[model samples]
Target: MTYALTNMRRVLRELRQERPADVPARLWRYAKPKLDVLGEEVLYRARLMGPLAARYRGPGIALMFHEIQSNVDDELRTGCSAGHLRQVIHAVRAAGRDIVTPDEALRRLGDRQSAPFALLTFDDAYADNRLNALPVLQELDVPMTLFVPTGMITREIDAWWLVLRAALRSRSEIALPPMERTFQCPDLASKTAALRQITAWVGTDQARAESLSETLGPLVSDPASLVARYAMDAKDLTQFAQHPLVTIGAHTKTHRFLSQLSDGEVLAEFTSNKNYLEALLGQPVEVLAYPYGTPGACGEREARLAREAGFKAAFTTRPGHLFPDHLKTPHLLPRIDIGYTPQRRSALFSRLSGFQRAMTTRWGAPVAVLD
Candidate 1:
């Protein structure tokens, strides 16, 4: 019992530092199915109470996905297996919701329609989106929006978070001169903690973080191969943009958190990426998905700049369903991140059904606030 208690504490410490973004969700992952079942029961009971219950239902929902691949060993945790992707589509449709493009959902919400709808969005321009997700989406005949970080395509930069993680995983010790710190990463737990600290520093001081990373030299033996393996290059982006059912959107120039940048930096990030995407795709790019997409990563200032830069809308990683009130503030749109676990099907449905949103509001205010 003493040994078990010690192990538990060690696990908690590692999780607290490494996965701060989704600590509660990660802790509840295993028990999610039971909670989802309870949520569904509550919803069913509410529906039995008559038309008043229907009023709480959201008109539309936008689902966010990162990578769609079966490879379990990938460093990025934001991927759902291809099989789960298919199941998610089937489950959403089975629940009697119409899957629509982000544009259509926006238009319909403006028209004040109460019909349930869903929108699919892919972020970071991962190659798996084309290689794995596209076939599933095409087979289901669903439309999706893909947000690209133009710098990734041009090879001007790679995702610093990925690079940091790779380095911590490979090396036993790393030095962070900016913070005057050194980390011992002899195991996955220590490496994760090291990654968390480094990532926070990167988020705060990207330039210094970049210099430090470069000073440390290549994390992986083959830097070029790593970039190609993770991100879509210019040629890949060109072909992906031509997909009839895919809508291309800008995700900034370097995939940096807008909230960390100055107004001028934010504007340049939006305009530069939008211009490059529009020129490459030969279509108007009017939507933006903030990198990181969380409240801390993007806020009112970033959203305003996005609109001023000629974008029609912007998305955040906030978990919620879309309401008519959201149309008033299109730039601050909320989205639900799909799970990567095998049993995420139920959790996906729970989110799509608005049960989670409803429960979330029961404790506090609604997830989607009116403008």
Candidate 2:
């Protein structure tokens, strides 16, 4: 208990300080496949339908992903890579579980008796989905949703994380071309502090910042060229939509946090992304995945906005299974974050178990607290 208290203190200290100098590495790459080659007891435990079935009273869990590409180099750098997609696919298949599609996942979430299931959903709509992730899923006959920020189609621009990377590099003499300074914190401590400060700002006001980025983005040197180099274009998206396993979902117009924005602003972000996707793909884009998807990123108000915006369902980063009561706000679907590294598996399973325990008891236990 004292150690837990001490750990909490340290976390609070860190949260109170500036952002991490390293930008906390946007996504972590798996150093190796998470599963044991010889197959360990963990795998055996994972296979047991009883513990999970008894532990998780709901229907099933759904997983969240961003980008999956063949280029390990790019993936390692971005933190959103699914380098072990095949390994993951094999594991899921061997487990003999169903890979539910987005529509089916939502429908079942609204049905308590629906079978145990999982669904794969990706965000950011990178070109690599078509080039890399699509083929494997197709081969496996797995259905997935590709949540795209439709505005990126015409303009090739880096995601905010990439922009932060570029900004970090600009401060270093890393042999990369110079980028326009977004915020100057001078030294590492200051940089971390700046990021922490900005993280709070983002949590509180991401929409304004996103809007500001757009006007100021062109002012950054080689804007068009940079966008071209990092993002998927309209042509790329059109090509991606051609796949049978790929269904389109909205990720807001520019991936702004809907909760931080005004009601109208939230509506604008949702409607814009939905309308843009519809116009681009010639179909209704009904599913939604909140940007960040974390608890603080958006909340009840935004969940209501998603339903009012005509989304049949929406998703969040909250890790758990879904049932009808869970879909009281059908738009606020909770998802599990599957990590690339083997080290993450234990933590993932632990978190899942903890979540199942908390749900069953309905105790207001704090799994974690900042301060």
Q: Write the per-residue lDDT of candidate 1 for residues 188-212, one digit (tens) a residue.
A: 5566556656666666455755665
Q: How accurate is candidate 1 locally (lDDT)?
A: 0.75
Task: Work out the TM-score per prediction.
Answer: 0.78, 0.69
Q: CA lDDT of each candidate?
A: 0.75, 0.61
Error of model 1, residue 19, in angstroms: 21
Instruction: Write down the RMSD of all candidates, one decimal each.
Output: 5.7, 8.7
Q: Where in model 1 is the C-alpha error above 4 Å?
A: 1-56, 168-217, 342-346, 358-362, 367-371
Q: Superpose all Cα atoms of candidate 2 onto the true structure and report the RMSD in Å to 1 decimal.
A: 8.7
Model 1 earns a TM-score of 0.78
By TM-score, the best candidate is: 1
